[model samples]
Target: MLVDGHHLLYRAHFGFPRRVTGSSGEDLTGLFGFVALLRKAHREHCPGQEVFVVFDAEDGAADRAENVPGYKAGRAGADHSPVVHLPAVKQALDAAGVRWLEQPGCEGDDVLATLAKLAVVTGREVLVFSGDRDLYGLLDGQRVRALNTQLPAGRQLVTAADVADRFGVHPVQWPDFRALTGDASDGIPGVAGVGPVTARQLLAGGRRLEDLPETASGRAGTGLARARAQWQEVLAWREALRLNAHVPVPDDLLTGRPTPGLVPAGQLLTEAGLW
Candidate 1:
């Protein structure tokens, strides 16, 4: 199972209250929340054979910043002073013997994608845990499944069929879908006039951004044409937005067992002073 560590951690950090803390007077809400998530995944999937927690390397934001100055720039100015027990969280994970992977230029999504692909080839059933919708593109071949924590209770299974039902496009076509629609969160400027509706039509029409007709009429056609123009920029930016899975995530980084530790939870709690 591949876990989107950054996505889950960040969500845990923000979703829960800030009142949780460790014995050291450090905030432990995020750590405790993450541990709870880990425990849930362990209990449900029993993927004890091989499990990986992939984190986004800090350096990846620089690449995004270079492409677009506003890429995750808001986080740069956010108030992180209140929740500063992250190092302890890492130590807690280490103490628990959970394997963690990170690559300098790639985000957690890329690492998860690469690992999922490898798992497919190796005859392993892959389950990706993340709240980010972008990872939905990786679902295919019945070998991959994405569990989105953002969905409603008992509706977290985001399958290939779910993608088709929700977005009117195939899972593989998501990247193309986003390319035309652009993602404000990631600072991707999708096709100019194309909204989600038009983007879906273009994708449903079986035309990639570059292959769409230049001038067309009707709501869908006009929006798609504008999207085609915007896609020109998206095509160039897509490379920047895409995750690089080729970067070697050393085996040493993932070296560990999945045994649960008694102190891991309390250590995380104490480190952040949630105890």
Candidate 2:
């Protein structure tokens, strides 16, 4: 199983109240929630399967920001007090024998994607845990599944068929859809006036943003014109937002095993002062 560490922790930090703290008098909402989520995920999927937690290294943010000046700019200067105990979280995971991967110039999503792709090639069942909808594009045969945390039920299991049913387009067309309908969260400025409906229609017609009819009639026509005009910018942003799985994974990083042991939840809570 591959876990999007940053994505899940970020959500946990904001989803709960600010009162959650650790033994060091530091805020532990994110840490506590993350541990719980990890335990739950371990129980629910691949009980004895090996797990990899991927974290975003600091270097990648600069590249993403450089690619699009406004990419994730909204939270650039935000305070991270709520997640101050993240180091403890890492230590906890380490104690629990969970292997983690963090590579310079690569985000957690990239690591997750790379690991998932590798698992597919090895014919292993891979489950990705993340809240980012963009990862939906990675869903495929029984070999891979995406567990999105933003769904109404707390998680949405995504497969190839689920992708087609939910978005009316195949997983491969997800980037195209995002390119036409901007994602405000990611600061992707998609074609103006083109929302999901129009984007879906254009994608369904088998036309990329660059190939849409410029002066045609109806919503599709207007959407095509907008897409054409903003094609370059949108494409650039898409490239920026897309996770690269070609990142070299060091054999040591992938094969490292944690010291075997179970981290008692009570001990973790007490040491962290959550008790």
Candidate 3:
């Protein structure tokens, strides 16, 4: 199982309203929730699976930001609650003896995607745990599946069929899908007036945006026509949105070394002086 480290950490920080505090009144809610989440995933979904967590490097998205103005710019000004607790989260991971990695220029999504591909190539099944829909693009029916522990049905896996059923696009086409419709979370401004329904229509029949005529009639066609001038930009967005499944991960990392046994959540907090 591959986990999106920061995604789950951020979710845990915001999901819990009660502020768990330490001796100096420092917030421990994020730490507590993060540990609990990992424990839950371990007890329920990870008993037999080799678990690895991937975090986005501090400057992971710098390239994308430079290429596309306003790329995740909003987050730059947002509250720091989500990342402030990361140090503690890492501490807990160390306590649990879990495996994780953060490369200088790679986002967690790309790292997870790369690891997933490597795992699949070796005939191992891959399950990605992340709240970020961007990883949905990494799903492959036979080998890869995505999961969001934040969901009410936390253990329910998202497969390629689910992507097709929900979004009218195959998992492989997810980047293109978002490129046309725009990913609001990342501040991608897709062609104005183009929405999911139209984007879906344009991308139907396994035809990519470049495969279609630049000019045509009707809503989907008109949207495509209007986007031609910005095709290069859109293409860049597609690349930005696409997960780099080839991020150089070492072969040894795939061997799943024996992690130290997990420390109980209560013990972890008590040891950290948060209890």
Task: Estimate TM-scores for all models.
Answer: 0.85, 0.87, 0.92
Most accurate candidate by TM-score: 3
TM-score of 3: 0.92
Residue 63 error, candidate 1, Å: 2.9
Index of the highest-lDDT prediction = 3
Error of 1 at 160 (Å): 1.6
Decide which is better by lDDT, 1 or 2.
2
Among all windows of ten consecutive residues in candidate 2, which has the lowest summed lDDT? 254-263
Q: State each model's CA lDDT, in order.
A: 0.69, 0.73, 0.80
lDDT of 2 by residue, 165-226 (tens): 76777776777788778777777778889888888888775565555554667997888877
Clashes of each: 7, 2, 0
Clash list (residue pairs), candidate 3: none
- Sorted by TM-score (best first), the order is 3, 2, 1
Please give the lDDT score for candidate 1. 0.69
Of 2 and 3, the candidate ranking higher by lDDT? 3
